[model samples]
Target: MDWYPNSDEQLLLRTSARFATGMAPAVSGARWFRDLERGDVQGELTGWPPGPTYQLRSAGDKAARRTGRALLVGIPLVANLIANLGGASGTPLGDVPGRGKPDEPENEVHDFPVMWAAPGSLARTVPWQLDPGRRPEDCVTDLVLTDRRLLFLATRKGSLAKADILGEFARDAVAEVRRMKFSEVNADVRVTFTDGSWVRLSVGNPDNAERLGQVLGGAVRMLAESELSEGQFDRVARFRADLPKTAHPPTYSRLRSGVTLVESRIPVKAGSGLFETHSILMDDSGQPAEPAPGDL
Candidate 1:
């Protein structure tokens, strides 16, 4: 559980961050080009474009290669517009790479207010180094949540390099964590700071993304192995015994109804550097049970 933020800090949650360029939160949507850099949530759409996106469009690559990539990125030009039009809330919103005019120039700004800080907020200070658009292809980043702080770590992808602690913020600095179900596979989260500034982040794993929201937002109570009752402990032990050796240790949490949810992550069989979560719910009798109302 030790991390760059603090040795001995309990590692509450960790998730793989966006790796492909298509997962960028700065992509255009209904909130395109909205600047939150000055903490002005209603400010004009004058946000600065991410430089790396522009670099891709520079005279370096062949015209055909650039055009081909653009089509892959722009076909929809804003899929969420259908769901979020008129500034109303929607659910199960699909994911978007970048959205704009079908032939939108690559140099244009595509910042969404949820992901771009207008000003004077903590999100504005998030290091560009964590941005996939700006980082190297083999680099990997992780957003780590612990009892004391929230931070990002950088590591060389598929390498043995030690993870580097890039940046961190005191837990108190976070004011809210919202699950954005509208995203593709329901894997996006909006992290808001105490000053009313927020940034949208896409966790590569949907289960991890939901866990980050539920735990950080206080919607459910996370429990440790020691907190389990004798019966529950035995059930969990047997469950873990049957999991693959590569499976991560199970995490326990209790809903308001006291139903225990135990979940674990295991590597995908394809070994494609991805993971999926497996979860089970138990009642007080330590028997598998269906989720209770409001327990989801």
Candidate 2:
């Protein structure tokens, strides 16, 4: 059967996509705190300790990688949905106001690194080996790592064509710094590489909400370390260090908060199956060691 969206799935996926983008990548499962802080989603950090110096934690197994891939592709929202759907217990209803359903049963709850596998599918592919430590509940929601490229998948309003894959950015764990942005589908986005060459991207693929993410990801350009300062580098490095040890950690930060995070996900599609793959690198929860001056 073709991967057609049921009405409920459509609503859930679309609604999830909007809110999903707003859901912040968590540090040690404390993502709720970030969501609450933004007033996008609700809830509080019940046991979180108060401190100006918040500890950065590592991401859980695949969950971290999945979240990373999502952010890399500019689909953090979709990634969050995939991660939660693969684990959390909820109706997957569009009307629900939160990431987790208030009425979800504890018995049905799932952890991060939610793995959905389908063998030998050409429509989708993933590089799961890259992240062996991902969990079902971590930010890295979906993943696909291959020799040619790394792919992240999220539930979207439409589908993605292969051509959209070009001009997108892939996760670079070894990179000194990374940046992401979201805007209108056709908005002109510029990427200046450290080498001075720049790439520009415009969003395409209206069929699948996930497809738009492919456009965003394909537009990625890598920057040189010189672009970031000592403090920025330190912030990214510390976040990387805190990510779960699945593969090399992907470093990231919020321009709004200046708090760095990491996460990624992958998608695999065969003739008859479509699945989600994931991995995690870092979490911003557990106390991270303060970086020495100029060490970043």
lDDT of 1 at 163: 76
Q: Per-prediction TM-score, please?
A: 0.66, 0.22
Poorest lDDT segment (10 consecutive residues) of candidate 2: 11-20
Error of 1 at 153 (Å): 2.4
> Candidate 2: lDDT of 245?
48
Candidate 1 minimal-lDDT segment of 10 residues: 83-92
Off by over 4 Å in 1: 1-8, 19-51, 54-115, 118-120, 160-162, 269-273
Relative to the true structure, how large is the alpha-carbon lDDT of every model?
0.58, 0.26
Error of 2 at 88 (Å): 18
- Candidate 1 C-alpha lDDT tens digits along 51-91: 33222232343455545655654432332232222211211
Q: Which candidate ranks first by lDDT, i.e. highest?
A: 1
Across 38-105, the per-residue lDDT of candidate 2 in tens digits comes to 22111122222232222234356447745665556444334333433321121111221223321212
Model 1 error, position 68 (Å):
9.5
Compared with the true structure, the alpha-carbon lDDT of candidate 2 equals 0.26
